[model samples]
Target: MKLTLTIWRQKGPDSKGKFVSYPMDNVNPEMSMLECLDVLNESLAERGEEPVAFEHDCREGICGSCGFMISGVAHGPQPATTVCQLTMRHFKDGEELVLEPWRSRAFPFVKDLVVDRRAFDRIIESGGYISVSTGNAPDGNAIPVGKEESDRAMDAAACIGCGACVAACPNGSAALFTGAKIAHLGILPQGQPERDRRAVRMVAQMHEEGFGSCTNIGECTGVCPKEIPLEVIARMNRDYLGGAWRERKNVVTTIAPVSDWDFAKK
Candidate 1:
C-alpha cells in the first residue's frame, strides 16, 4: 500500500519544528505503526537525512513508552489500542496520516514524536507507594480481599502511565492518570496506611506539574489503550476531598478566586 505522512519534526526542545511530508509505499498491512516509522527511518538513512525520532521500548504494548497522535486521534482511531499495537491495515491506501507528539504543558516536546513524560515520574515519586518491609513474601491468604475490591483495584492498576489521557483531553488533564495511580493502591489493604497522605501529596504534585484540571469530558478514558475507566477520577476526587477536609478544618479547595466583596464585609 502507499500513503503520505505529514509528521511533526523538531530537532530539539528549543528548536523550531514543522510538518515534513514523506510518501511511503509498499507498506505491509501487518506492519505495526512503529515498524512503519522504522521503515521510513531506514529510507531517510540511505538518503543521508536525519531520521524522525520517536520512542518505543517493547514493541509490545506493556511498556507504555510508545504513543503519539495519529491523524488527529490518539493511537489512530483504534479503541483501547496502543500505537505499537496499531497496524497499517487499519488505514486505507492513499490515506494521508498526520503524526504528532502528545501535547501538554507538563509534557514538553523533546524531539520528532517524543515528549517528556517524566512529569508522570515525579507524580509517582510524590507518593504513589506503600511502605513495605524487607522480608520473605507473605502468605497468599494472609489478608483476604473481596473479589469485587480486588477486581476494581486491578482495573485501576492497569494504567500504564501512557500520556494518551493527557493528549486526548481538551483540558490536557492528568486527572485520569493521577486518579488511576491513587485508586490502584487506595483500594488495597496494603496501601491503607499511606492513603490519606498519598492523596494530598500526589494531588499537590499534580497541580505543581502544570497539568490542567479535569472537567470530566471523558476523552481521556476514550483513547486509553488499557481501557482505564473514568470512575478512577471520581475515586481520586473523593480521596482528595477527604484528605483536605481532615487536614484543613473541613475546607475544600475551589477553582474560584476569593470574593473581594466578602472580604470587605468581613
Candidate 2:
C-alpha cells in the first residue's frame, strides 16, 4: 500500500515545528507503524537525509514508549491499540496520515514526534510506591486480598504511562494517568499503609507539573491504549479527598499556593 505521511518535524524543544510530507510507495500491509517508519528511515539514510525521530521500545506495545497523534487521534484510529501495533492495513491506499507529538505543557516537545515524558516519572517518584521492608519476598497468599479489589487493582495497573491520555484530553489533564497510578496500589492491601499519603503527594506533584484539570469529559480514557476506565479517576478523587482532609494542616504548608484540594471541585 502507498501512503502519504505528513509528520511534524522539530529540531529541538525550542524550535518551531512544521508538517513535512513524505510519500511511501512500498508500504507493506503487514508492517507495523514503527516498522514502516524503519523502512522510511532506511530510505532517508540512503539519501543522507535525517530520519524521523520517534520513541519506541518493546514495540509489541508493552513499554508505552511509542505514542503520538495519527490524523488527530491519539495512537491512530484503532480502539485500545498502540501506534506500534497499528498496521498499514488499517488505512486505505494513498491515505494521508498526519502525525504530531503529544501537546501538553507537562510534556515538552523534543524532536519530531517525540516529547519529554519525565513529568510522569516525577509524579511516580512523589509517592507511587509501597513501604515494604527489605528482605526476602513474602508469599503471595500471605496478604489476603479480596478478589474484587485484586481485579480492580489489576485493571488500574494496566496503565502504561504513554501520555496518550494527556494528549487526547482537550484540557491536557493527567488525571487518568495519575489516577491509574494511585488506584493500582490504593486498591491493594500492600498499599494501605501509605495510601493516604500517596494520594496527597502524587496529586500535589501532578499539580506542580502544570497539567490541566480533568472535567470528567472522559477523553483521557477514550483514547487510552489500555482501555483503562474512568472509574480510576473517581477512585483517585476519593483517595485524594480523604488524604487531603486528613493531611490538611501539614499539606497546606508543604504544597502551599497550589490548592491541591481544588481538584475536588471538578
Candidate 3:
C-alpha cells in the first residue's frame, strides 16, 4: 500500500513546528506502525534528510512509550491498542495520514511526535507509592487476598500511563490516568492506611499540574489503549468526595475550642 504522511517536526521544545509531507510507497500492509516508521526513517537517511524523531521502547505496546496521534485519533483508529500494535492494513492505499504529538499544556512537545510527560511522573510521585517495606519478598499467601479483589486490582493496574487519556480529552484532563492509579491501590488491603490521603494529594497534584477537570465527555476511555473503563473516574470521584469530607472534618476539629471539644466529647 502507498500513503502520504504529514508529520509534525520540531527541532526542540522552543522551536516552531510544521507538518512536512512525505510519500510512502510499497508499504507492507502487514507491517506494524513502528515498522512503517522505520522504513520511512531509512528512506530519509538514504536521501541525507533528517529523520522524524518519535518514541518507541518495546515496539510491542507494553511500554506505553510509543504514542502519537494519527489522523486526530490517539494510537490510530484501533481501540484498546497502542500505536506500535497498529498495522498498516487499517489504512487504505493513497490515504494521507497526519501524525502529531499529544497536545496539552501539561505535555509540551519535545521533538516531532515526542512530548515531555514528566508531569505524570510528578503526579504519581505525589501519592502513588505504598508505604510498605521491600526488604524481602513476602509469601503470596500471606496477604490472604481474595481472587475477586486481586482481579479488580489487576484491571486497574493495567493502565500503562501512555498519556493518551489526556490527549483524547477535549479539556486535556488526566482524570482517567489519575483514577487508575488511585483505584489500583485503593482496592488493595495494604493501601487502606493512606487511602483518603492518597486521593486528596493526587487530586491536588493533578490540578497543580494544570490538567483540566473531568466533564464526563468520555473521550479518555474511548481512546485509551488499555480500554480502562470510564467507571474508574466515577470511583475516583467518590474517593475524592470522601477525602474532602474527612479533610473538612479534621479542619473543624482542629479549629474547635476546648469548650466545643468538651461538648462534642460528651
Give the candidate number with the greatest TM-score.
Answer: 2
- Candidate 3 structure quality by residue, lDDT tens digits, 1-266: 99999999888766678999999879999999889999999999999988899999998778889899999999999998899999999999999999999998877667888887877887788788799887888887887888898888889889999999999999999999999999989888988888887788888888877899999989999999998888888878988889977874432111111121122224
- Candidate 2 lDDT, tens digit per residue, 1-266? 99999999988765667999999999999999999889999999999999999999999988999999999999999989999999989999999999999998778777898887888988888888898888999886998999999999999999999999999999999999999999999999899988989998989889988899999989888899999999999999999999988874554212322222223223
lDDT (tens digit, per residue) of candidate 1 on 126-168: 8899998889998899989999999999999999998999999
lDDT of each: 0.88, 0.89, 0.86
Residue 137: error of model 3 in Å?
Answer: 2.7
Give lDDT: candidate 1, residue 13: 71
Taking all chains together, the TM-score of candidate 1 against the true structure is 0.92
Quick one: how many clashes does candidate 3 have?
Answer: 0
Best model per lDDT: 2
Report how far off residue 14 is in candidate 1 (Å): 1.1
TM-score attained by model 2: 0.93
lDDT of 1 at 11: 89
- Candidate 2 regions off by >4 Å? 252-266
- When sorted by TM-score, best at the front, the candidate numbers are 2, 1, 3
Residue pairs in candidate 2 whose N, alpha carbon or C atoms collide under 3 angstroms: none
TM-score (all chains, Cα) for each model: 0.92, 0.93, 0.91
Candidate 3 regions exceeding 4 Å error are 248-266
Better of 2 and 3 by TM-score: 2
Clashing residue pairs found in predicted model 3: none
Backbone clashes (count) for model 2: 0
